[model samples]
Target: MSNDDINARRREQVELNMLTVAAVAGWYIDTYLDKKSCRDSALSGAAYVNELLIGHLERFRQVCRMERPIFMKLCNVIRSKNLLCDTRDITLEEQLIMFLFTIGHNAVNRQVQERFQHSGETISRHFNGVLQAILSLSTQYIRDPSINVPIEIANDTRFYPFFKDCIGAIDGTHIPVFVESHKQAPYRNRHGLLSQNIMAACTFDLKFIHIQAGWEGSASDAIVLRAAEKDGFKVPRGKYYLVDAGYGNTPNYIAPYRGVRYHLREFARGSIGPQDAKELFNLRHSSLRNAIERVFGVIKNRFPILKNTSSHSFDTVTDEDINEPDDDYNTDERRREGNRMREAIANAMCDEYSIHTRRLRDRHGH
Candidate 1:
């Protein structure tokens, strides 16, 4: 072998050595990446499990806004319905708790991630999954209103007999929303905030009977109602709902007389009772109609997401319905008769009270 053969052999050896070094480096980098990924996954899973186990039952309720039993029941329902299944990394309970935490507190994804010790992506994925699961159970949770008046409401003299024909009360409230620039004008309400006109109806028990949301804030209550009617808002031939002045007194819908004191607070000051026929009618109407307001208050309180405008797509329909009544009754006539009866009763009560007061005064000799 001469000088040329020797040089060629040396070059081949150097090339083989470099290739071997490169192969070893690649294998080390791949192993390090795989190990890091596994460790991260394990830590995330452990963190979520530890957080859930760290708190007492009351603490769970305080954070999740539901009793542990109710939470467990809901979890069982989800599992039974196959709405959500347990995964290797996150269980069904963790997904639900995280989602409830976000809704109950109106927390953002980042907040939920930090609380659960997970990545933003993981938090978002489970949040959306739980939301879809809840929506799927809407039909099961929402009930159809019965024709008979609920015993709880019927027993109350302030509501019964007078509200016998009233299946529920309907009203529109503004919920803050976000919209594109071109669409913002339509959603800007009287308060000059972008919002959605959410019209809802609720029974005496404060359970929602119907909801028509996603309407523009600028839309009038009457217009939205008309749209609802057009879209098959069922009102039995005669049963009606108590509504505010923003609605009209149709054959099946009763609105308080305009220019009359309506809200309960308005009658709280200086007056022992209603002053006139309109006032009497309004007093009764407001008392029954206030159920819907209370329902809204409870819902907003329980789920802060509805209280403020969050960065969510407003196009999604979040309307819910439960306990819808069947068939309509003679609403207009019933309302008129009920008003007269209510007025007569009020006067008689006031007169009786006055007589008792005079007797007491004579006894006291003041």
Candidate 2:
């Protein structure tokens, strides 16, 4: 073998060896990726459904914020309405679970993706799909106030006739929000936090009758209420809604007298009872209107997402089955008669004020 021939043969051998190594490495990398993709798909498919079934019932309720029966009923409703259909990899139940879990926990898309072992895109897509489905059911779930008074209000003598025509309480709450710089000015409330002013009306039973959201935080409550009115927020000619002093005292809306101790806390803390007719009216008004505040409390407690707003733009509507009133509320003339009855009761209460105070003191062991 000549020196030149030997050198060429050795170089060719080295080239062949390098080519073989490269081919093997390529095949290994492709196989690893394929395996990873399949594993992820499998995890995503089973994570929500399997966990919901095999885990504790309380765990399911904790994640979805409803009992198992209620959750299943909601799923059936969505299915029957044709609001959501199963995809190749994700079922309707899984999609609903993911949606509720995300909202109930105020989780971001990435967090949901990790929990379900799905891609970020998949998480985003299904979350939006379920949200739209829920929105479609709003009309059916959010009902109109009945013509009769709720038992909670009717049973309370202080609120009965005074608030008989009052369908519900209306208020504007600041819900924290996130927006771009250009939009932040409008969204920033008086406290200088980015928020959206949401106007909601709830009955004495803590059921929402109307919800108007997406208003700028800087907007006043009255402005939002007026906007809602234009957008089909109607009050029957004889009925009214209780509102705070932020709203005007129109015939359709009743507001507490300004410069009065209207909060229930003040009355509970041994504050003086109504000193005059206006004060008496306000005291009764406050007592009835506080139901709306309690409704807000219940909702925020049930859905923590309201406390900590999510970046994703979504609206929430909570509807629990409530019994309807058996009969129509008192008529306008009867309500006026109720007003006279209230005045007499107030006088009697005033006459027995010392005894009531003594009882209060005795109860407190003071």
Highest lDDT: which candidate? 2
- lDDT of model 1, residue 137: 88
TM-score of each: 0.74, 0.75
Please provide, for model 2 over 291-346, each residue's C-alpha lDDT reduced to its tens digit, 9 standing for 90 to 100.
88888887777777787766765233322222222233334765455445445545
Q: Write the per-residue lDDT of candidate 1 for residues 242-291, one digit (tens) a residue.
A: 78887756646777778878888889977667766567668877877888
Q: Global lDDT of each model?
A: 0.73, 0.75
Candidate 2 ranges beyond 4 A from true positions: 1-45, 313-366
Cα RMSDs, all models: 9.9, 11.5
**lDDT, candidate 2, residue 272?**
70
